[model samples]
Target: MSEPLVVPEVRRLGPARLTAGMDRWDRLDFAAHRRTHGPLPRASRSELLAVADRIDLRGRGGAAFPFARKARATLGAAERSGRAPVLVVNGAEGEPPSVKDATLLARAPHLVLDGVTLAALAFGAAEVVVAVASGSAAELSVPAAIAERGRDPVPMRTLCVPDRFVSGESGALIRAVNGRAALPPSRPVRAAEGGRGGVSGRPTLLCNAETWAQLALAARLGPDAFAVVGTPDEPGTLLVTVNRSPRPPVVVEVPAGASLAVVLDACGVDPGAGVLVGGYHGAWLPPHLAPDLPLSRTGLAAAGGTLGAASVVALPRGVCALAEITAVAGWLADESTGQCGPCRRGLPETVDALRALSRGAGSASAVRRAAALGRGRGACAHPDGVARFVLSALTVFAEDIATHASGSGCGLSSGLTLPLPRQAGERLAVDWARCAGHGLCASLAPDLITLDPHGFPLLRENANLAPWQRPQARRAVARCPALALRIGR
Candidate 1:
């Protein structure tokens, strides 16, 4: 038997975090962190840009855009004299299968904080906000870490937001911090505009928390030292969330040039099945064919996939892939912030069609409906991504889909072991007995609640909208004569 790689227990911390502020914690001592991975001497903006350019450091936040280039683009806007940029460290791990961000926030909060403060210093930003999902463990843990780091006195704040997925997007977080609804705007405005409204209406620089942590690492290592491990174009190790059977969840930093085979072996992944690369917005690949592929942006890009927020999910045999996709489609529809019309109405419609396809109840018309409804009507990539995920699943699993569509046997009853988002904690629920079907709740808060065919209230999606809508949605919550609706935030 081939030996399986033992997935290490990831603390995600550079030496400093392991030491807890270069200080002592309980019986454990981490003073060596600063000695080994001490902060780099502050770099001038030009020198910082040079360091970024040397390593070709790209945003690890899925887009992977060149960091130096993005800095140049945003820096010019930030130089508007006394209107320093707003640096936002995005800690909201919205992808259900992705625990890397939350893991880092919990285990290596200082590493992330180090990156945030470094960027703020580099950008001369007046304000910094580390946004995490409200009510999540991050809400508490991140704040605690920041307070503990008071030893290093950095200008920073924390904004706990609702756990809605789309709200984690860069622009949406900006809008939410500005007291607007936590939904993507209808227009694609670059955040550099820093127009009047939120966060002092200043130029904003947003990046994933992991990306910042890497930046902190890059600063210390310098570009050449950083290039020692990973590929030429993509230097340094990256954090990946590996999900396969038998192995517990792990967050590991594999060199960029490492083979996919090494990663699989490290994670104890079994020989062959479908691999969900990237997150839901990413593509799926079969295992036997994918193992030899290099584990870099260029490598995955060559094969029509992206190394998204670093979520890799391996699906075993016997589980119905079609049914799994269907359930996720439902969850994706429910996750939308529902500020856009196409995403608001279209995602659920797409889910309805996929559900029909799962039950083998829909005709060619149903397939057409699914394809037509959610192609590109959303403000962000949410709707388009859902369409892509479903369409790809249908194409890849045509054999299984045919088995169901023919009303024969797909032989699976929605065995949803393939990881996806699920509702956690208390959420809004309606008492069916008390429902009068007046449709008032749907009308009063159309963005959140909608009326189904039975005139019963159906949740459009999870969100904590603008302050006014909060009260309005709350009023609708109380005004229901049947007292069936209750809002839980």
Candidate 2:
């Protein structure tokens, strides 16, 4: 694979929390980590819960779920059911634009491991798992950190899985670790509830890589000290990935209530155009609002966006907003798991509609219909997220849409600025040169395979079958009388 056009740099603002000592390039070995951050603070289960409640630390992952509540529930479930709880440090870093988790694992692996060890001690877990995306730098860094620790009370292990977009979801991670397909299950179940019998049928305490780091810091600093830097409701530092056009992105740790504009400026990003906060699944906000908005979740929520994964992609001038949206929409459609009807069908339809609008041949009604078809209809949030992103693009760039719809092009060519995965999922293929067009594949997996005008089987556009869909797709391939159907990467 070609190297990324823009690689992200890492830094810290105010006092560093998880990013301490990152600038030195020295791996915080076990001794150094202890010296820098004090001894690994030990806390009882109740004390850990109390500290989490007081600090109001939320998961650093995109969900931003309350950490205290999740911890309490997981502990409660384990106790009630008499099942041991397993601690999982999720360093999958599935979102292409985000780099905080990988940064932590690379520069300060011991801090993260300390956090995991602390959590395991609190939960009385016999084993702890640190899951990194396969082939990531963290895949090597984390295991080395574990080996550096030698023997511990709770054994720690590292597991690497394929780096797909949805594979980082909590349920999907659990499912993947349990030797199942790394796709979200049809039925929603919390890992804390012993969902799908997580990692040997035990209750799981899953937290984002940064969340574990924060817990370790909070245990060392106590609630009041941690609250000194951030807001009242949400206190502590945030790791933000800033992607400015024409420049590589950078990950910076800033206080929660820091001014968004200041953070962007410090990262040398020109927010004069618009900004896509969070990752691709997050919202687009007007650049003018950056100065006044706080970096906290509540503040971003009031501004009609989220601090999702704390990723900020600056939209530069001279690019057509509609064109950019079209590119991102097409990418999202291709990334869908294809398990649910809404995502499999609605996302591609939405992409086509957006493309039509960019060419001045589509109506707003068509785009709206496509968005509605996908919203709230999928087993996972993939469809809903796509709908939200597309709808927001339509609303935020209404003037641009109007101009494009009137046949006056936005005067800019489509240059995709957002980062997407370099590798695409495997797609279904047909051997048209070898055999007759029987259309058996279409009959076997109608959702994934469709009939072309020539009665030959054509894999549906953007139809990258999910784990659940593979069975039928394989069946269709096997049943092809002409021996023409196959899957290709």
Predicted structure with the largest TM-score when compared to the true one: 2
| Residues 409-436, model 2: lDDT tens digits | 8887567777765556667887868659
Q: In terms of TM-score, how similar is model 2 to the real structure?
A: 0.90
Model 2: how large is the Cα RMSD against the reference? 3.6
Worst 10 residues of 2 by lDDT: 1-10
The CA lDDT of each predicted structure is: 0.69, 0.80
Summarize candidate 1's per-residue lDDT along 337-411 as a digit string, tens digits: 666766766776676676676667864357556656766666787877777666666655667778888877589
The segments of candidate 1 whose C-alpha lies over 4 angstroms from its true place after superposition are 1-8, 11-32, 135-137, 151-154, 196-198, 245-248, 363-373, 421-489
Q: What's the lDDT for residue 187 in model 1? A: 70
Residue pairs with clashing backbones, model 2: none
In model 2, the runs with Cα more than 4 Å from the true position are: 1-7, 195-197, 424-441, 448-489
Give all TM-scores, in the order shown.
0.81, 0.90
